[model samples]
Target: MKTLGLALALAVAMPSFAAPPVPLNTTDVDALVAKPAKGTRIIALWALDCAYCEQNLKALADWQRKHADVDLVFVATDPMSQSVTLEARLKAAHVDTVPSRAYAESTPDRINFLIDPAWGGETPRTMVIKSDGTRRALSGALTTARISKLLD
Candidate 1:
């Protein structure tokens, strides 16, 4: 009886895990970017296979901690089949609690083209979309200074 009670207590004490990633297609991505709202919205693209992506996620997570009011969205480039691994990575970066989506398509090239034809499917790609829908794209691992500038 004590063991059973302890198990229940542990379960209740644990932090709630994030929900599974939703299907993200070209139309969905377009809708997300086009959605109108105040302030700047950050759309970060990353993958579990990319080392630089991990760094970028950690930087973004730290920046997010200080700027809770800023809107941020994460898009995992890995296929939906890798959602478990993706979730674990996000948790490690402390950004799993944020709004996140994963690629539903099997073909990464298609997803890349839809996001930005100019982009060559780079990991750690970040897009900052302003309230007016103007955007700035940054590619490569994010630094603290870069994050501060983007947020400011």
Candidate 2:
């Protein structure tokens, strides 16, 4: 009985680990663009220091809960060293359960170029890629109505 009690206590005291962010490179980004999925995919690029990113993340989490069929991908533009904080932020937003990737390269420009040449390294950048390979990129926090429209 004492052993069972101790085990239960230990379990309760243990910290819950959030899903680790996968490393994303230029090749991976290229592949994602080249091999378009059967349905629409929401690709969100964020950073830990970006204030707007938090709002977008929360909105995305809520949106994802309602649309289970939508393919939502989170890309952290921060370096790999900040993966812990990135995970924490995602967990707090309740979107950590979805697939997430972190920029592996130290140079932000390289990663930014891989994502989009026109992008001026903005946080909370979102891209809604349709099944037909067409996409709409929006920079900044997304409104609930916009999210719904994008999913539709």
Candidate 3:
């Protein structure tokens, strides 16, 4: 009877867990990138499984809090993970603040316009987007020094 009661309690409590993040497709992603005002600049793209992504996500969040004018959008290579597994990992890591979106398989170029084929679907790939639609793409984990250099 006690075991059954415990099981029931666990089941009841599971619903309190955070719901998975909403998956945003290619068109939806473009809209997000386009939403910024005339002068909006962005740090875009990252995978959920990457350590560098974890650091960058946290740093970007902190940076955004200080520089509210800048925007950050994390793009996941694996779209399906965004809704459940990614959400859980992000939550577990206490990474909040950076808004995340999934890359649509149908439009790979539009999703990660900057990654080279050598990256092998790695995370922590990053891009800097200017208001004029110009972009600078970087591959590999983001370090503080690398981010500073890129921004400069």
lDDT of each: 0.81, 0.81, 0.61
lDDT string, candidate 3, 26-112, tens digits: 556556555355544554456655667777777666655676667776666767644676776667656544566666466666455
| lDDT comparing candidate 3 with the true structure | 0.61
Model 1 lDDT, full chain set: 0.81
lDDT of 1 by residue, 1-152 (tens): 99999999999999978876677987787877763577777888998878798788777877777875668888999888888888888887777877888998778888787777777888889887777767778888799988877656
TM-score of each: 0.83, 0.82, 0.65
The all-Cα superposition gives candidate 1 an RMSD in Å to the true structure of 4.1
Best by TM-score: 1
Candidate 3: the clashing residue pairs are: none
| RMSD for each of the candidates | 4.1, 4.0, 8.0
Q: For model 2, give the RMSD to the true fold.
A: 4.0
Off by over 4 Å in 2: 1-17
Order candidates by lDDT, high to low.
2, 1, 3
Point out where model 1 deviates above 4 Å.
Answer: 1-13
lDDT of 2 by residue, 49-99 (tens): 898997897788778778766677889998878889888888888677778
